[model samples]
Target: MNVAVGCKVRFLNDVGGGEVIRIIDKRTALVKTFDGFEMPALLSELVVVEPAADELLQKKTVQEKETAEANRKKKPKSEVEYLTDDSPEVADSSGDELSLDIAFVPSNISNLQQSTFDMYLVNDSTYRVFYVLSNVIDDNHTPISSGILQPDTKVLVKRLTPEDVSKLIIMNLQAIYHKNIPYKPFQPEFYDIELDPIKLYKRGNFKRNDFFDIDAYIISIASTKREAFIRHLTDKAIVEAIKQKEKPAPVKEVKKPNIETEEVDLHIHELIDNWKDLSPGEILKIQLARFETALEGGIKSTTTKRMVFIHGVGNGKLKYEITKLLSSKYPKLRYQDASFKEYGFGATMVFLK
Candidate 1:
């Protein structure tokens, strides 16, 4: 194979085509093409192909090259995945996972007046309604919309059948009522509503909200509620809240000591003298305290600036606490490890908002 620079070759596999740029070894050659790509190809993979005189084989224009470079420099947009179908699990910062158990109900049950209500079916015999009377209501009933429920309108709810309850659970009807129903709890009250005897014996004591209970009763209603109820007491939310609560507060950057031209030697000697007397821990503590003071000052002063915490490399406890505090308290600010010479491994820099 006499493939040399400028020789055209078609790759044996679907490796595409290129022009030879450098002969690497007896069996390998470097190829550079009009697409601005370079790759190594084995001699067996390349066939000595004749070049076509078409404009497609020409070198890229300066504008095209600039566009290609800009495109290469562009980064993909960041995405946050709140929910996924593959796994019904969500993770928090503390690495805990949570799942949602959702139930749906119909939108058209007319007699159901409460925006939210809890039902307790006792002994599979009695249907009791724990009615939470709120200002929220639907289009048909705007009792609370005028800031008061009409004294004449008596709000009543009926118990649903077993089949209706199953449909509500399957459809996740609570989400619909929560999103669509307009009711605010002014003085919520609980009441019990007994269903017919046949429905009570078949379905045991199942707890559900009024929207879900009513939707289950009116199965003929056709609206679909697509929201899922997120249990607030999950491990993930609790863990995250705990972490945020426990994390350390942000440290503010110190303004470099105002050194006039004549003060350079004095400043140098002061730094040197301080370094000689202070142990790494002492130096770190003093620096951390200074940063804290500066941070408080910045917040109080409403002045935003960069602050550096100078803790020298020994154990990184001070550094860790400083970073944790900044992340937890002032998450909007930017933070990073300090420069190598400034604090070695122990110091951190923070940009305050």
Candidate 2:
């Protein structure tokens, strides 16, 4: 007899009746009862059945409600009184006594394995041993502990050799074929020696002729006239250090100053008195000079006020120059072609900052 996952089956014998939970293989089935205990049994020992009526009825009712809702056209009511007929208090406790059918199986323990430096006890009845292994142990070892194992925690079990058991008890040794093996100590690269130059030079710094050959240099210096070699190397090192100290620091780049001319707004009276008859270019030059003077004055005064360049609307040359200068030189100043009904396009408005 064969069973599959979620197959509905009932017990044939009286060894605790339940539904089949899963199929283990061709002959076995994992079954669970409504009371929550589970077991593996032969498929020949159970009978297949349709699902119970209570479950079928609940499913039918849900399907009917969904069908009704899908066919309906009306929008759902938002207010509680219109949406639901039941009182809030009765609705709250309606599902309190509902119980679900669930089952639990005994956890499988055969996959647990002993780790290096782990101990175990053998259970005589089942020929299986229970023991705590280091969580670091290989997965192949049997009767292993779950999660993190605490020191000195006794694990119950069976079916391991005495040598294997003894190896587990020894704290710092790896268990190999049921025997304890001591850990090897790691050695340091260089130990207990002074780095003298005479010893370095004799080791042949001249063979490779490489400047970065530190080890060869050390041996060569140490082998040859030791004191003189040390003094020469030390003096050379000092001279190199002094030369590095004498080298000049790098200089930072400086930005060039902007040389474009600025636009300035002259007083209406001043323009009439001293600048009215000048040509457009001459008037532009005067305006630029005035712009520089005004900028210096504003900076010194720390005031941000509007200055109106009252260039009348003749050919619009002066206004154009004024606006161009303002954009290039005094870009931070808020500028616009002056309002027509008031100053008209003949003047440009400069907002000082």
Candidate 3:
């Protein structure tokens, strides 16, 4: 980014955010910090700020501070407890030892549309990991953060802007894993982690997880082991024994119901006596099964010509589902709305002959 005299800018990787007072060269610039100090910073690391946008950013910060202070003075209320490593339910996990992921925690969960995110490199295992996190732009990797992450912990790598979250196409995670004690070695991994920027816009994408105190969007980068193991309250670990392969079971042909009558009542109440406790989905499932069975049998019968399935009109969901299934699965079968005079817009008639 090109910088001119008296340009407002913020340092990308540092705490000091101020304005650019002088342009040193093409690659360097002199920035006046908020603390009244002139610091030589790289032009690449200086993010230019608009005056109006900067005002709004400062206002938002003040509002957040006020809200935090207000909450502190208010009457104390019971808070929901989330899972932590100290919790009894989170005992030392036996399987899937080397878990690794990059977690994105929203800075403002209430206002997700404009919220920034604190990105974290999480190492949820016993292995000491050396990782380099990079940003991939124009097929080139720009180094962002690199460190040795301790076992079962996470480090905040970068605080992402709203624009950064929206344009998050991809990131590169490079890592090598090892334990201090005697252990099996893992090959160095170079992961090109793909991300959905569109989904990041939704508040539901960030969730309260076992790792972070705040809700986060965690994308697992790698795990060193995939072997399944059983855990018990003993010094020894258990492994499943090898068993002989059993003979394959014979597949039974589904017996389709013979639709001998001119009409098949596919309603839940008619098909089953105990459907009062069933959910709408369960009811629809039963009706579809009955419809399929009758249709399959009707098409193959020699005498049966026409079949009318009475699926009552309730928001047209069942009718839409039935028609869509028939059209896609039985393209050759001719079907239409049952005679309105007889069925009153509640049934489908199929020509099987």
lDDT top scorer: 3
The lDDT of each candidate is 0.39, 0.38, 0.69
Worst 10 residues of 1 by lDDT: 171-180
lDDT (Cα, tens digit) per residue for candidate 2, span 94-119 = 11111110111111122222211112
Maximum-TM-score candidate: 3
lDDT of 3 by residue, 215-264 (tens): 88877666544222211212211001101111355988877755454788
The residue ranges of model 3 lying beyond 4 angstroms of the native Cα positions read 1-13, 16-96, 224-353
Clashing pairs in 3: none
lDDT of 1 by residue, 227-252 (tens): 11222234444334333433455888
C-alpha TM-score for every candidate: 0.20, 0.22, 0.40
lDDT of 3 at 50: 44
Q: In model 3, which range of ten residues has the least summed lDDT? A: 237-246
Model 2 sits at a Cα RMSD from the real structure of 35.3
